[model samples]
Target: MKVGVLVLAFILAFFAESLPLGPLYAQLHPDFVALLILYWALSSSQVLSYFGIWLIGLVQDLVLGDLPGSQAISLVLMLALLYGWISRVRHLPSWEQLFFVFFLLLAQCLSAWLWHAWVGPIRWHSSLLLGPALGAALWPLLTYLLDQLQKHWPRRKTP
Candidate 1:
């Protein structure tokens, strides 16, 4: 069922995102959870509610040991910004959608960076952009794979 697949995808993404890559690699690693959220948010059917996304972000914050609610705010804001034009975005070519994902990830990253800069010590560097860049680069592949998964999933029964 769609819901089952959705839950599975999110679980896998959470674990993947939480992997212990080295310090440099970790910074460069794409945020798999955020990427999955974006994919589902832009899908033909709205797969995740706003609160669900917020909860996921909060979980990410807890997992990453960041301040609670920082990621929640960022992800909810990102979904709010995209919700208005999701239909239009769903119709875009995969390449164009990649650009959108890049901007979304960039914004998410910048928002977190700003939060850290405000309340905690964080080194400002050029490499902060790498994670978003890599996320964008991986968008097409993630989309394709998820699309296939969704297509193969059994349709939910209508009551």
Candidate 2:
């Protein structure tokens, strides 16, 4: 059931990323897929393995039509760093967690941007910098909604 929810969230995020918002609004849009990956990585139970993160990144890369491995690398690296310190991060205060999430989102976006720039043409624009900030800002809301959904999910009985 948890896996089902995660898959649904990933699908929703994939479609959301492709929404036809104008250029400025699109740049400001949060990277929902990255946030979902981060959320699962930070959970008490490891819901996604390294391979799962890589697969999600690959799907994101395909959906966005970017260089094949750019997003996969960024996401896998971010998950590696988070999973390594999940014990410590899970104990931090909410505000501090948000701060950390900001940097994580920023790093993911920056890495992807760098990859794109390295392989192909991309115009310099301030909006490019807005994505991570926007994603960080949306973190609380996303967390709350996912928490509610998880709490309400039916649990299986253990024999």
Candidate 3:
């Protein structure tokens, strides 16, 4: 049942992440799949863990037509960063959460940029830069929606 819920979430993220915004928007776009996965993974024990994150990231890499494990590494980094912050913060409101999401968008973009620099130049990649900016702007609404999903569907624990 947990696996089924995660699969559903991944499907949703794929669509959310694949939205064909203008060329300028792709780079800055928040990784909905990653974001959702992280949010649920952190908030719910039923959701995927580090291993699941890696698998999703690898799928994302394939979806974007990049080498495998790029997103896996990025997911690892994002998870680590999230865990670090979770330990420090308490009673975070919507605004602060939005800020954190935005910050993470930038981190994802930076990871992609470095991948390009190290591996080879990926042409026509500027939109991803804009993605974080726009993604930040959209964070509040997205988080709200996801939170609601959590509340409504609320994955059931199975032992």
Candidate 4:
């Protein structure tokens, strides 16, 4: 069932991105999958690893038509930070649980900005920050839903 959850997560990410954006503007383009990936990496490191993060980031890069390694590196760093913090917590709260994801999303945005820094004439659109901010803001909802799913779903029996 872990595999099933991973597959579902990827599918959600795929469809979330596959949809068309509106003509108005996109400074707030949310990284739906990245948030989900970070949540699981922090909460369930045994399930989502650096390789998993990199793989999903690669898929996101391909689908979004961005540089191949940017998201991969972004995700790896996010997971590593989360993992380090998680190991240090002996009595972590659900709120604290969500906070790490929020932090990672922010880092990803900063990373994205830094990536664009190398490229000339950066848009410097204040709106670009919206995506990660919104992603971080949505962490509580995402965490609740994920918790419910894990609680109700019957996972495969471990050996």
Using TM-score as the measure, which candidate wins? 1
**Candidate 1, residue 24: how far the Cα is off, in Å:** 1.8
Q: How far is candidate 1 from the true structure (C-alpha RMSD, Å)?
A: 2.0
Best by lDDT: 1
Taking the tens digit of each residue's C-alpha lDDT, what string does model 2 give over 93-125?
Answer: 555677778888888887888888999888777
lDDT of 3 by residue, 1-159 (tens): 245555777898887666778654454556777667546644564534678678888888877777767778777777767777764432476566767766776687677567767787666555665666666677667657766665677666789
Give the TM-score of each candidate.
0.90, 0.88, 0.77, 0.81
Spell out the clash pairs found in candidate 1: none
- Cα RMSD for candidate 2? 2.1
Could you give me the TM-score of model 2 versus the true structure?
0.88
Could you tell which candidate, 1 or 3, scores higher by lDDT? 1
True-structure lDDT of candidate 2: 0.80
Worst lDDT run of 10 residues, candidate 1, spans 40-49
Which prediction has more favorable TM-score, 1 or 4? 1
Error of 2 at 141 (Å): 1.1
Cα RMSDs of all predictions? 2.0, 2.1, 3.5, 2.9
lDDT of 1 by residue, 36-142 (tens): 88887777464567898889899999888888887887888777767766877889977788888888888888888887888878898877799999999999989
Two-way TM-score contest, 3 vs 4, winner: 4
